[model samples]
Target: MIISKPNINKSRINICRENSQSLEDIQNQSSSSQNQTPIIDLTKAPELNYKYGRTSEIATLKQWILENHTRLITIYGLSGIGKTALTLKLISEITTQFDYIIYRSLDNLPKLITVKNELKQFLCQSLSKPLPEILDYFKSSRCLVIMDDLENIFQFGNFAGQYLTEYKDYSKFFQQIANSYHQSCVILISWEKPADIETLQSENQHTKTLHLQGLGEDAKAIFQEKDLKDDEKWEELITLYQGHPGWLNIITLAIKELFNGQVYQCLIDEDEVFLGDIEALLENHLERLSELEYHVINWLAR
Candidate 1:
């Protein structure tokens, strides 16, 4: 009897598909309770509602997520800089592109959320029908998991500049996930970037870090619609707001008073809090740096 070698490409293809299915099934058996949305659904909260701005950041993130080689990326920036909104927007737009997509906002994670435990919960939920342990699940499946503000859980060391973190334990887990999992991706969104984790990260050619900036023209349109006018006020308002949607929302409230909801109000109301808050806000969020950093930012702003 002649024993013929099996076809090389066909055999390899079958093996790949089988391995993929096995990994995917790990989180398919999720418990009923874990099926519900996490509390940080920014879309529903008034305080967390989506606003126009950060278009470039959203586009960058969406493109990065679609990359076959990129298994992870960070959408990092200062607080109230539209990171969460950009993240949610990207997730909503790209759900169909992934085998599995789950978003867990690390807005207020418990202090006890260790790397292992967090991974376990996510794996459990991702594997809804007969959820298995996280480690075994990632073995074969391709999944997209986003943990917003992961820096909160991580502790910092030498790598962190000002925003030090100690989430080194999570760093190792992420490396393992990326190396072993064939189609797994993770995104960490945070107010401050952690250098410790960045150091421990693999030298992947595909990993990306997107730092968000304020909005441009599109954001002005969003604000204009709210105040109900199309005039020079739109341009003036955009300049004042600097294209941060959250800030624009506050500005919108002020404009409503002057325009009486009849038109866009270019003039700052004498009694308005918006004008008062801008300077202080700039000092608070934008001036956390040393004197040199402040100078640099000011120079760049100008």
Candidate 2:
């Protein structure tokens, strides 16, 4: 379910239908009409099940891609902050404007050469001779390439965005995309902003970053979806969790099972916020922090 703020000048976007055709079907259609069709490869992307309240994010991204022509964009946030969902929603709205829409994931930390070859092969499939470089396709076509789970390339125990020694080449690839003149856009989605993003944004108008945050009142939909009780107390619950869709969804399950769907019961302890199942999610985020960063958080808690 998509929940957007009213009066936002956004085209009506139908959520990805549950029974939509498979990737092979779409690829076949593109093959039949190579010149007119947009080559789409979403084999590695996550299915957007329920997206809540990213209307402004979508509009800003659309403007960057369609108007300002941003070449590189990094969407970063805390774990479970809806980065993937927002991008999926944006793709749904703007897919028709591009000649190609490709989605790749760095979750397994593939090498730079591997990724380059995969993208090159996919983008060059219709050509008589494969292009010498990936940028050639970018120059010849309007493409939207999304690389998700970028944090996988970074060292987990290091400060955020520090690439592992072996994955350092990905930084150069991103630099090339931002510095070179191209009609395509590459969006990187991660839990932490890459180290080069700040420098790139300051130096290049085409390079941009969007730091995603929580959903606000619109997150009430998740609670409603779970059939939680005490409708009037949802605002308090949302505020307590900062309207994080992932965290809210987890908490709703806890309330349903533990408090018999009564939200107030979970909120009764004013001094303590009950994390319930969210503690495990928090642990995953903490595991990625550097020792110093982890200590700083501990100090803050004290």
Best by lDDT: 2
lDDT of each: 0.53, 0.82
lDDT for position 89 in model 1:
58
lDDT of 1 by residue, 1-302 (tens): 12222122211100111222222222222212232221111121112455565666667676665654566677776566687766655655554445445556655644324544655654554345744555465444545677776655543322222332343456655556556545667787876665544654456645667777677687766655674565666766666666666677666765576656532444556344355445666665454455666677789977
TM-score of each: 0.63, 0.88
Alpha carbon RMSD to native, model 1: 12.4
Question: lDDT tens string, model 2, 1-302?
Answer: 22222121231121232324332233334344434456566656675554468888899999999999999999999888899888876776666577778889999989999999999987875589888999999999887899999999999888889999999999999999999999999999999999989998999999999999889988998987788999999999999999899899888999999999999999999999999778998898899999999999999989
TM-score of 2: 0.88
